[model samples]
Target: MGAPVSVTCLSAPVSVTCLSAPVSVTCLSAPVSVTCLSAPVSVTCLSAPVSVTCLSAPVSVTCLSAPVSVTCLSAPVSVTCLSAPVSVTCLSAPVSVTCLSALVSVTCLSAPVSVTRLSAPVSVTRLSAPVSVTCFSAPVSVTCLSAPVSVTCLSAPVSVTCFSAPVSVTCLSAPVSVTCLSAPVSVTCFSAPVSVTRLSAPVSVTCLSAPVSVTCFSAPVSVTCLSALVSVTCLSAPVSVTCLSAPVSVKCLSAPVSVTCLSAPVSVTCFSAPVSVTCLSAPVSVTCLSAPVSVTCLSAPVSVTCFSAPVSVTCFSAPVSVTRLSAPVSVTCLSAPSLSDVSLSPSVSDVIISLEVLASLGMDIQPG
Candidate 1:
């Protein structure tokens, strides 16, 4: 008996058996059941339901306002500023858990688990698992009502926020940036290089086989078959990209990139740079390539097909179809009333139309 045992305003059931001395248990709002073995334990301002067990010294737990459950074996465990639903388990030392606003679950078997600034709804699992995991400023807010978050095998750098339940991220090989406002997010087997930003839900990214760099932003995004050697960039939503089987480089600045190529070799670049590309659909057969294709402020509809390459179309207002021009083909229609179907086949070398699209092509211009 080294003389220091203070249990203030107790209701019932309090046990303290110290062999070497130094044990201070303070309960301000009562309802306490405290047990300390083998000295050195400090617990302060506990509202209700506190269980502290320290074997072989050095355990400090502070400020548990409501609903707290802590269990530490073999010392060295520090838990700070917990509001509600906290369950901490430390088997063999080295665990620092910080400022959990509400609902947190932490477990460290062999040490090294750092969870930082989580604002409600959290579940972390590590079984000999922690080779650099850094997650910063996870924002899930809209009254914060949708919950179900899982992060598995995170090999450093994870930033997540998906509102409206249903977020699953698996095997993130590193470099993952995700942002979805209306929920419904699924990213699977990403071998580094994944950047997703969608505002209105309905996002599905599957089996990104490797060598990945995907950038998507808004308007009902659906990207499928991101095999390998992938680089996709979509800006203004209303997007449907399918089966981009290897060697894909697509860049759409003001929305309207519908490129369908089945036999590989694709490089589609549309940049009005200032918002006014209603539609640019490149429908390929064997070879339909545009090296220098530019449409400055086309309202709608400009379909071009070149067998040997080089087809240039510029339309200020709708409907101009140029077919199978061998090489060096140019069709310019400014405020087209009606080009009335311009068809030129026989290895078209050079054709230029500017006189208001050749007087609206009154005779259905057919020169082969």
Candidate 2:
């Protein structure tokens, strides 16, 4: 019923070895009828008809778009599906399923399994055993009600459960965890820890609930949280934070750290650790960390956290940004000062510069 299919390897060395009793020998392929043995066997068919039956043997099977029906009676197996739909039914066998850009459905009875699917929906139902499932870009629903299970879903939602074993689920949206007689863990919504338990374990948990740190400099309004620690550095500008529940530390040249705090302390340092701001009703600790810098505080009882070496600002009105200057100092002004207004020290020498004889000779001065 599907499109044209290619089966690359199938060998039937001996003709029909038909027996009512279960055979346990490796067998090859025929165009329409291919049966294998109890020993693990590999079969490849190129544009061959799809009838492959293996009795009591583990198998590695690959088919391109032709409905592949492989029944592994009792053994472990691995299946990979690409671009086409594949349905694998394993009876009392441990299985590993990988689906890439295709829809895959797997049903296993009394087996432990691990399934990884990318870009498509993969539904796996395992009755018992430890299960690990990871899905990317699409939804993955797994129901394994026997052993420990861990599921990670990225950019999509996931629903997973383990009855008598622990279940771990991490997804983009709200993830639900239901278990009895076992511990359960869930992480959802931007690295936020969410825990669910009816009576024993905590019913709900959300951590790093808000953006940890946000910084914007010379660009459009941007906000980002660096989880656990919040540090913002702005140039000579204005920075405002709505609610900062964590310890707020700021070190800037001339910028102001204005914050309305509901729960935590605000610390600001400026200059060499110059500008320090302490605000709201919370107790604050401040450290002047900069040198040769200007400091402006807008609150009371300012404390220093830590300070480096001594720093001095020699010139402020001219906006001179040098900590130390070397001699000899040369001075030039937009408007020249009068000779009497200029005072020369003992180290200064006055040389009489004259060009009278060259002007008398009618020679013009030009920069070569």
Candidate 3:
């Protein structure tokens, strides 16, 4: 065992803390089976904000690949660096990142300089030499479920892109494309990219060159309601929507309609099941009123097609607001408003009349 080296990194604007200690302790000078001895150490600021780098013995402790964003941070903290038999604390002057020992490292990759978050190319040069770290960008999170925690996920991107010519690092449209270009120093995985989308359009939708690139993530071609009176549930991941819920009752382009168990400790069964709830539509779109229940016009004359099971709509606001529903739309049910008596407003009178007229002619009034 040898006396480990120490280094500290101050917050940005404050240049890196170098291991400038002149104290020299030669590891070779020790006797046979010699006890730990201090070695001459040199700390360099590979980059600002990053405090110290013990050049003597490569102190490879676990590092955070994902930006550890602590919203509840009370004060500035220190990120300590460690070597076997001894540990070093690199103080990042009253800054937030307090790296507690939460992970382990298997290998250390060096290019004179290190970097992270490569969406576009941003380069760095260290060790009195120049090197390149071409990093790729992903649209979503990649999970290495079985691997260690050293996995690389570019929350955003920067690159050591300065070169003689343009070096193109393919930016993946999806998380699955994050394969090692050459070789990775180490890898880790948490939760992989889960497929979530609106029946109409999905947010956080990745940039893809092909359709159904990942079929698991594809939005349903269409949803239909087979019954006028139906009960729909809401579900998220790993919950099958096909089961226990009607189709198309869950309209896309609506509100933040998501699937959740009618009750707590909800047990999920199939893939599309329980029920799917997501705020799909926009301001001019149909907004979900309740849990797979009611909906109203966000603006005027909005059309909404349900995606879940048998469901109905009961207008709560401006009953006579919506004008011409050009797109095929469905009528929702009143929440627990027993059908004792209900009447369409004068504004909605023509809508119901014309629809009935079209129904007689077998004309489609809603988006199928």
TM-score for every candidate vs. truth?
0.36, 0.46, 0.25
| The best candidate in terms of TM-score | 2
Backbone clash numbers for all candidates listed? 0, 27, 70
Candidates ranked by TM-score:
2, 1, 3
List candidate 3 segments past 4 Å from native: 1-300, 306-308, 317-368
lDDT of 1 by residue, 1-368 (tens): 66666665544545566655667777766545455556676666566556666665666667667555566666776767567566677766666666657565676565555555445544554444341222333322111124444444344445455555445555456555566566666666556555666565656665455554456664545555555554566665544445445555566554555543333344555443221122333222112343334433244455555454556666566566656545676777666675464455555356665556776556454565
Candidate 3 lDDT over residue span 38-148, tens digit each: 233232232221222333322222222221111111122223322111112221212211222222111112222222323422222221222223234422222221222
What is residue 28's positional error in candidate 3, in angstroms?
A: 25
- What is candidate 2's lDDT per residue for 63-152, written digit by digit as tens? 444344566667676665455565667778887777677676778877777878888887878777677888887766777766677777
TM accuracy, model 2: 0.46
Give candidate 3's whole-model lDDT.
0.25
Which consecutive 10 residues in model 1 have the weakest lDDT in total? 136-145
Give the Cα-based TM-score of candidate 3 against the true structure.
0.25
Candidate 1 wrongly placed segments (more than 4 Å):
1-46, 49-300, 303-318, 321-337, 340-368
Alpha carbon deviation, residue 237, candidate 2 (Å): 49
